[model samples]
Target: MSLDKRKQAFINLGHFLNQFNSNGIVKKENVLHNDLFFDAFKMQIKRAEEYNSWFTQNNVLFALESWTNALHHQNIYEWLKDYTIAKDSSKTIAIIMAGNIPLVGFHDFLCVAITGNKVLAKLSSNDKYFIPLIAKYLEYIEPSFKGKFMFTEEKLQDFDGVIATGSNNTARYFDYYFGKHPHIIRQSRNAVAVLDGTETHEQLEALSDDIFRYYGLGCRSISKIFVPEDYDFDKLFKAVYKHKDILKYTKYVNNYDYNKAVYLMSLFDMKENGFLMIKEDTSYASPIATLFYESYTDLEILKEKLNNDSDKIQCISTELNIADSVKLGQTQAPKLWNYADNVDTVKFLLEL
Candidate 1:
């Protein structure tokens, strides 16, 4: 199949996703296969919520909307414009997806399919519904995709390469097992924000989205902050008050209560505003309902520290003129070319 056919199939899928939202589901007359897929996709969304409590309807729609905006013809063309994809030789690429957030590994899946490779996906148990349903939609749009995609619960085999997302521990296992194949194995990494106490209230409020979205589960979510010394907490706390509604989620509230109790029992120095807690720590990964922060004496020294620990970091959010830093509120909404772990997935797939 031609790469143009594959790209058009995904653009059709994007149009299908654009019809559903939290307010209501509206079927557009122009969307392809609406008569067959409109109702089925709605049911799949409900099933996804039932399968995992973390996959709430809002979050699921958010993921869909993000992809809907991304899969336009122009966007897809621009993303692949720099790469030369070889469609003559077909290979199978196995993907081990991580389900910390909805569709966390969909980017890898898209790369594999777009680059003319068969996808052997092992879906995370927490996220079994959405991707497979989308795969079916793609098959309907372009029948050639019918046999190119496979989802399995058994051990993966008969693949030329692998892309796996897991913790630091599982990366060791992936390295040992998939060592001989061309692969990209991603480990845990967390995002951080840099604050110089010069940020506007609006900027800080937008930063709250980076912290609270997906309940801070995804690697792109901001889990830590770097602030200048003697920074006051009053403005930051007041700004994040906009997201106090997040506490209404039962699981998030439970985590807040439990972590707050533990911190109090241990007498840790921290600050809280009932919904979110900020603690001073040197760690990058923070628990649910909590954020870790560290004070930096010198901006240059802190830059050096972050550079030295780049592998442990995903993307940095800052208003300062820092190299490769994402805007304050744009960390979670990554562009098509914002490769994870600073690794080029399209280049990897082309080489395979």
Candidate 2:
């Protein structure tokens, strides 16, 4: 489809969503505030609340806005202007989505749809309904897409390019099996926070949202804490303690117990409340029962180390960009123009 046609379809999808909201087909939750363009997203969040707290309470507005904008900004014909796909319409591609957080699969959906390929999508059992709604809308807009997009529990092979998402362990299986095929494989990842100890208690408290949000399930959640040496643990705990009610969730308590047990066996000293755990470590990622706290002296030096280890680090959140501060907790979720995985997606698509 042409860019103008695709944009029109996107607007139509947005209108369809608003129309759904108008007819009361979806329920309203705290996160489901009536955004004019992203009403379907509110419905998706309300549905997700039945399973996950992070999706229920925080309302990841970005997830909704990003999908609509990604579609609107997409230029299907332009993205395919350079690359070549098999001229055969029968060619199919397999897509395996992640249930880690809301709508992480949308990126791959946009990729295949805009490329005009037959999509053999295996929806994550965790996210069974939401994307199918979008797909249904797309079929409504372009009837030819009906046979082109499908959902299945079956494995797929003999395709053009395969895109699969899973944990670091499963990625190896994807690699060994689909390695020779053209593909983009995404593996497990986590984000981190760098604290200079100069931040106000209020900012630190808000930062807690970035940490415990979604129960630290999103790749963007802060699982690690890096700080200046001599950082005050009392103050740090005080800042996070403001969100003490997060402990009320039974699942989080179970995760806390499981992780604390593992730590005890590993001989790591730690303290935990009902939901949150604090421990000392140099790593950037931590388990649900614990948060890794590391001390540093120089922001520049820390930035250098982060730069050296950029492959392992997803984002670096700090109050100020001291020297090489890479803003943390703001990874993966890109701005309207920010491309997926920090690659210029528009350029990639255009050059396809």
List clashing residue pairs in candidate 1: none
**Runs with alpha carbons beyond 4 Å of true place in candidate 1:** 22-24
Best by lDDT: 1
Candidate 2 error regions (>4 Å): 14-92, 142-144, 264-267, 271-274, 322-333, 336-352
Local lDDT at 234 for model 2: 70
Per-residue CA lDDT of model 2 for 22-71, tens digit only, reads 22444334312235324554556566767655454344444554454444
Please provide TM-scores, in order, for all candidate models, with all chains considered together. 0.98, 0.78
Best by TM-score: 1
Candidate 2 lDDT score at position 215: 72
